[model samples]
Target: MKQLAIAASILGLLACSPQGEAKLSAAPEGFDDSYLQKMGFTVETVEASAIEGVYQVITDQGLIYVADGGKMLIGGRIYDITGAQPVNLSENAIRQMRQKDVAAIDGEAIVYQAEDEKYVVTVFTDPTCGYCRQLHNDLQSYLDKGISIHYLAWPRTGLQGSSYEQLKTVWCSDDPKAALTAAKSDKRLPAARCDDPVDAHFALGNKFGVRGTPAMVLPSGELIPGLVPADRLLNTIKQSQ
Candidate 1:
């Protein structure tokens, strides 16, 4: 299956500050993330983690934690275990980033607008994937429930293949929606090219951590990584409000 990938390192995010207390950051402390450059990561921003000394380093690729003035790299999420149910502080930070990224590319997506249009969800999809095709096939079901679908291309094989070319044709087509439908049906698309958003969409999906096709970004910026039924997705959107 193909996939797309988020925004805090899901945009370079600010430190997660505790409620009633101001947020602290590592940048002002002159913490050098130049060490990250040695590892080939473009350092976007660095912020203080919920942990006392750990800093969340937001990079062009994704989020990572460092400590001891960038001497240590912690490759896992931070959780507030003090709560009755564990809250993933890292995930929360990334979600906010996703919201910004989604907004930036809002109109570029291939959309299926509902009549009432109660909710909008951005989906990073690949016509090459079975689940993605299924989701496309159920477009009317989703639309009927007032759920509008916006599709972003994510070829999933890292952008160099027939699949990527096929998807590009869809975005570059005179009638993108029809081309997309044809592609999903395994019909060969006539080769076409333009200033298509296909490549940009793929990169955005990768940043959003789309590991597979049919990754849906809910209205609240939370990423749901699979094919979901229309009725259930509607309920989810309502609950998120």
Candidate 2:
């Protein structure tokens, strides 16, 4: 099966909910793991949000918006009704969660730090991706502009076959940056073995709703997917600041 289909299959299992009037909680009772399972949520953590009558729930599938009592689940995006501009509540929630989760991954990431390190961004990369190769080539340009790049693996082919092995080889290299450059330049690494964090990174990328390589996560939790030029990226960082 394809990577997208495999991801969707995992989500399908968590979509099965009991057929009945779903109850809502009056107060935040926190996330009840068993209750969430019964209601078809592969529960991970539930967090209180600024919005009343709503809770941000993190499940194995991804982030979801649910009512206080865990009724009326919204799998997609949510918007704030009372606003001059339409505020994407779901996007904001996901951004917050992304920042928190990505922060925890700082130490684990293969980092390409800038000398000054004015801005920090996390990239979900796949070795086999063409755009990812382009991005890797311009890594120095970003560094020159004081942008620190952190890499997290997101194999386009998921945890299987040559794609997985290639990523493992890169991660296992004594100098990962050199390994990545060689791989991107069509010089394949020799067959090697090691216990790699490729699976963990792939899982995290999925949780962050990363459907493709070269997806970037800014410090403010906004997602920018695809190959963004160095100048444009600098402008974005400035705007966010």
Candidate 3:
């Protein structure tokens, strides 16, 4: 089913409930979550907003707003301009969620440890993505800079067909790292399959709003949505620290 887009009309900071009462412990009693689920949204969280009656909804795709007890829905990011510096409240919440969700899959990732590692990054990648290949070609550059990279598969095409099957082979191989390099280099692999985390990794990538390959997740849970050079990435990490 085609997913519904966030309703444009409700995209701003609407009036929220009073302070203290503004925090939603859970989806409001009057809210009908089924309505959203039916619209092809995998809603992950619902929280009360600073705006009266408005609620912040986090979904696998991104942020949206709901109001009037679920009668209205708006899709977009919201910011608090009243703060000393503008705060993207929606992104902040999503970042926290992203951090938690990415961490949960650590055991399942294809990890390349950097010697004397100073930072770790999780990356959503597709074998067919040119930029992903570019990053892979310079994989050691990141390691040289003391950045460990944990890779998660994210086929642009849905979990079916050649790409998915190829990634599955990489995950199932006796030497997954070698298999991955071979696949990314456009080499065919010996067919293989087993219980693997490719599906879970793909799902997690979607939940974190990964629209394309080479999406990098920093230790701080901030997402950088492209192939960043090792030196540039190292600088970014240092600046964040």
Candidate 4:
């Protein structure tokens, strides 16, 4: 689905006022900023959902649903039951947020664009991940099939550790593609430091529901969270087209 379409779908589910304005209210006293922040929400706006005791919150991080006025949080999919066909409200919102957040990281991504690109995929990758290495080895096949691959670093370990430092060295290198290639080959990069997007990439990946390396975001914004073989990946891209 197009980015706009995905966004529209999310908006469709959110309860709106009669004035056609999004309701923004402060969360209850106990459900203050710090509490929500602990649950990964930097709450910007909060609105009452059609369902009582549930509120839809828009955060700097992403959209989320909370209960107990914000004490409880739901991070996975939510389905709307009133429609002819059930609508995956939460997943659609996540996809829209994922597209927006991923787009911002495109410049930071290590991209391998096909000469005649027919499709584009964003990948969350980890250098130490075995499956990620296998996927990287087949980069040529993907490019040959006219699939542009954009890679965002996702150290399984949180920032401020060895994995973060390794990714930093790769992104900070003069030739990031070469550095990534070497790192994936189990060759260590020289110790280096610079303003890196490692933290941002890792955080964004988490927000996008990336629990593992080699996770793929297709052109339609559908997320596939495992390593897919070259042939199967190519077929998926073609089908999306």
RMSD of 1: 7.8
Between candidates 2 and 4, name the one with more favorable lDDT: 2
TM-score of predicted structure 1: 0.82
Q: Against the true structure, whose TM-score is highest?
A: 3
lDDT of 1 by residue, 111-229 (tens): 99999999999999888899999999989999999999999888877577867888889999999999999999999788788988887777677666777888999888788899999
Q: Provide the clashing-pair count of each candidate structure.
A: 12, 2, 7, 0
Ranking by TM-score: 3, 1, 2, 4
Off by over 4 Å in 4: 1-35, 38-40, 44-54, 60-62, 67-76, 82-84, 238-241
- TM-score of each predicted structure versus truth: 0.82, 0.80, 0.84, 0.75
lDDT of 3 by residue, 85-185 (tens): 99887778777877888778788789999998999999988888899999999999999999999999888886887778888999999989999999999
Q: On lDDT, who's better, 3 or 4?
A: 3
Model 3 has an lDDT value of: 0.78
How many pairs in model 1 have backbone atoms within 3 A of each other, for residues 3 or more apart or on separate chains, i.e. clashes?
A: 12
lDDT digits (tens) for residues 1-241 of candidate 4: 2532433244343211112222345655555455554433345567666577777776644566778856566545578989899988767766666677677778988999999898889998888889999989989988888889999988877675766778999999999999999999989798777999887777666556667788998876678888988679989877754
Q: State the C-alpha lDDT per candidate.
A: 0.77, 0.75, 0.78, 0.73
